[model samples]
Target chain A: MRRLYTILSAGAVLGLAGPAVAQNPGDTPAPAAQADPATGSSNRARSSQSPAGGLAAVSGEDAAAAPARADGGTIPPAELKSACERALRDDAEWREALGRQLTGALLASLDQRVDDAEPDQPAKKRKLEPWVEQLSTEIERKIHQRENRAIQRNNNHVIMAYAALWALVLGFVVFMWNRQRALKAEIAQLQLEVEEAAADDE
Target chain B: MKQAMYFVFAGISVLLFFYTIDLIFYGTPLDAGLYFNQKIFYYHVPQAFVLFLAVIVAGVASLLYIKRRDGRYDDVAEAAGEVAVLFGAMMLVSGSIWGKAAWGVWWQWDARLTTSLLLWMLMVGYMLVRKYGGPSADRLAAGLAIFGAVNIPLVYFSVKIWRTLHPEASVVPGLQGSMRTTFWLSVLLFQIVFVLLLIARVGQSRIQRQVREVRERALDAGLLD
Candidate 1:
């Protein structure tokens, strides 16, 4: 009885911890090139993100990517390459400063500890200041938009995973069903043949 | 009555699957960082739960078979082991996709992940032994099943036991709103599917055994000669 209890308990524990799941790897181990992600009071508003913050990060990534147009017009074929490169370098330092600022803000929020003894003190002490909140909005919006692409990609991966699972499961079922049908049919035929032979001998 | 029960179970399973779809799309937005890959949470974690339960069922059934030496116990053990391997493989695949999305790698030898892999391999080995081992295959595989069962706790607790990137074991921690509802509902759906699959597999095993017995009877009656 004790042994049986152990097995069930193991099962319960496994479910509680199954896959050790949900905390995103992106959040913990690999935070991507963006500054560590930080949230503010569960404030999920478009205004929470900064447009310039996103453009700054994207521009960094865009340094390697192609530049389609310069100043709303196409550059001469020969100058296009250098023009795009120049544009990439343009304001890069300032944009980087923005990214850094956002990163610092996130880090700061993380370092702040809420006063547990005074339950209401947390909101007063740890709450984002107005300026910090504004900067956070820009940073968060950029992060959300950028991460949306990642989310879409992960969504695709999830779709693929689900497809693969269903395919394998359905395949197993069909395989078993066919095998069983054939065996039952063959066995029935074999029994009939044996009965016929026995009758003939008698 | 049994067939009606099977149909009822299948219908419920299908209904639950659709219900899960509703929850996934309508569930509240996940916390900032976990939003995207968090979608996998619905399927991946539930599948993991199924894997864990299947392993336990296999282990317990195998243990019973070892003690009683009953063919019925053996059939249940074999059925449960096969389901474990199925769900375990799915768990690994789905998890690798998640790891790639989150960690930027397809595989990580972290404590929870590694131990889960080992447990999966152990379950696979348990099945292979039944399929290929000598006449003592049942007993041999039974012993291996017990081993697989014993290792589940280690796999489940490995994140706690080691320094690992895998998330800690709070299956329901901090989940307050729609996220909580979607999670438990998904789990229930998977459990139903798990039961349906196990019943089908065990019935197949029983049918195969009956066929073999009939063939032996025909041979004994001199009809095969």
Candidate 2:
């Protein structure tokens, strides 16, 4: 009974302990504190590559002129690096920036490709226009799907972590429960013996 | 007197069971603003509460047997433990099926799921301890039941403290009134069923004990010889 109790207690402790270890504070880095340098650099690079980059060279260009455009603003390298570091650590912000950069890049590339592949003549151009439109739509859809997949993967990782934690807790509870049951049984047996002894004496 | 009480409990359970079915078929499917998987809630949550209540009954009966050494109390504990195990098992199966329908997965390691599983295992352990732990099994079974009962709260609170997948309890202060009424009704109906089952099982156990006692007395008197 003692041995069973020990085993059950250990199992319960381990079960409860396992999840705490798995959910270590170190495992889930504070999202806002750690920015992804890659996303920051990518956004910076894309901004530089946009028509907004041209406006940066124009003095009269209002900072808000390309609110809807992909112009590289005068974000200081030091500030950008800090923001990137912060974003990398912070999943929400990193994802938002990554999504914006990816969408902008995709649209810009599509525009450039269409310009380069101009169709010739009225009848043939009309016939090809629908095909071009369909291809462009397909590309955009694929990009969205890729973004969604990344988000899903991240969510799945969190879920897996939670599952492990729960399993540990369940194991611990079962262990403790078994131990308690065994002890109770032992006590009951001892009590019965005592009762019988008293009755025999009488 | 006991028989009359049993009849009352049985009648109430029968009435509520029909009422639950009527609510499911006729009542507006649980509103979205109220709670997700509303239809499953009526049955699943009540069954879970019933399972808990059954275990508590077992624990109480076991304690009484230990203190008084009344063979009758042991009978009650054993009966309650058996019924608790049955209801706990049903809760697990039904909860899993509901989870599959609502969450798109058959099971998730949510706090509620983990705790319920632990409770079920404890219930099984209680039965096993009674069966094999010797003639003085009542004390042991009671101890096990008490220990298992203590863990129920820990299991519940663990999810709240940790980042668990299980949703927070829906019947909170901010919850709408309609959902609360439905939830309370389910709890009441299930509690009635649990009581009825316990009484029926206890009666059967008492009958069995009486039969065993009569046979032992006859053998001692050499009536068979």
Candidate 3:
């Protein structure tokens, strides 16, 4: 439960950290979860209400439904599904963050669907692994593709700027050296002419 | 001393080569939002500082020329003006690239940008007046430089005064952590390079002036070919 709260906090913080902090190009494999500071499983029920992200939003809705069931009433499945979808929409801020959080919600929805169809939680977990793995692989590939393009564009600008600075400095140096050489040659010519005129007079 | 300056300048160039590589690979990561192309900021701002300093040095020398009419002060003013123009061109071009990246436009008529352009043009005008203003060209150009010197404060403060797209002079308040250190270090390197260039330029200008004076003397003594 404490671990769940940490994931929730990371999702919220990732949304708030803005887009720049969200992607670290290629090497950083999702460091967004480090912001979690939750401890103690006693607060398990409250963790769902802790603004963790889309998953917590759905979990909080389930907690709400529990009280409704205790009062001898139940939320219709269709209505509950619509509410969960709306909650996910509001909670997920970044496309990448949404993809990550929705995977959990999707897994839960799949487990619920599998249970309804087969009525076996143990076999259902086995069936879910392949789907989860496939989704994770696809998500990672998309993220790397987008971030690599951004990194490449940024690298181009950096190359252009550095080239320009060195070019300007070297160009100025060459110009000054040529100007100095010309002036020295002119000075030598003037001195030679002055000496010839003096010798002619003598 | 001039020879030592040339060696020191070469050393600084070597340092800049490695420093720029580090900046490319490990400098403060690009601003993720609207300022993604701010890698150029490290280069642009420092160049602007040295450019402004060169302008001020030339302006002061121009004032000295105006006061005593000394040919030495005139030579220094001309040398300083040319150096100022050189760095100023680099700053303006680099700045345009940064602007195009960040602001989505290569040029803007906003307060700070316009005033900066005006200042560059004024420096170029100072050079032109020296080149073609004929007799008493130094005095005329010196007067033009004094006017340009007046515009320096206006150009610097324009963003603050008129609320331009350009950030204010108080960007110091926003800097934090290693970025602040990196910025100041780059500034220090640019100043070292600026001093080296100024020394070399003044020496060359002195030699050119001596050549001109010697040719005038030889012609006066009927030494023409």
After superposition on all C-alphas, the RMSD of every candidate to the true structure, in Å, is 19.2, 21.6, 15.4
Clashing pairs in 3: A8-A52
Residue pairs of candidate 1 with colliding backbone atoms: A48-A137, A49-A137, A49-A138, A49-A141, A50-A137, A50-A138
Compose the digit string of candidate 2's lDDT tens values, residues A2-98: 9999999999999989987875565433332223433443433343234343333332355444333246555566776687667766777667665
Q: Tell me the lDDT of model 3 at B124.
A: 93
Residue range B1-225, candidate 3, lDDT tens digits? 958867977797678757755853587665666334676777788888887787888889999989987788887888888888887888888889988887789988776677667778888999999899998888899999887897778776764466566765556558776667677777877787777777788888788777777777777767765
Q: Which candidate is the best by TM-score?
A: 3
Off by over 4 Å in 1: A1-154, B154-163
Report how far residue B121 has shifted in candidate 3, in Å.
0.6
RMSD of 3: 15.4
- What CA RMSD would candidate 1 show? 19.2
True contacts kept of 3: 0.51
What ordering of candidates by DockQ runs from best to worst? 1, 3, 2
Fnat of every candidate, listed in order: 0.54, 0.00, 0.51
Residue by residue across A1-202, what tens digits does model 3's lDDT show?
A: 9999999999888876756665545544333322232321122212332234435557677545443555679757788767756765566454345455455555565555566875545673546543344456557977978887676567677678768886998899899999888887887877787888888988
Deviation from native of the Cα of residue B99 in model 2, angstroms: 1.3
lDDT of 2: 0.63
CAPRI accuracy category, model 1: acceptable
Model 2 stretches with alpha carbons more than 4 Å out: A1-202, B1-5, B33-37, B155-163, B172-178
lDDT of 2 at A60: 31
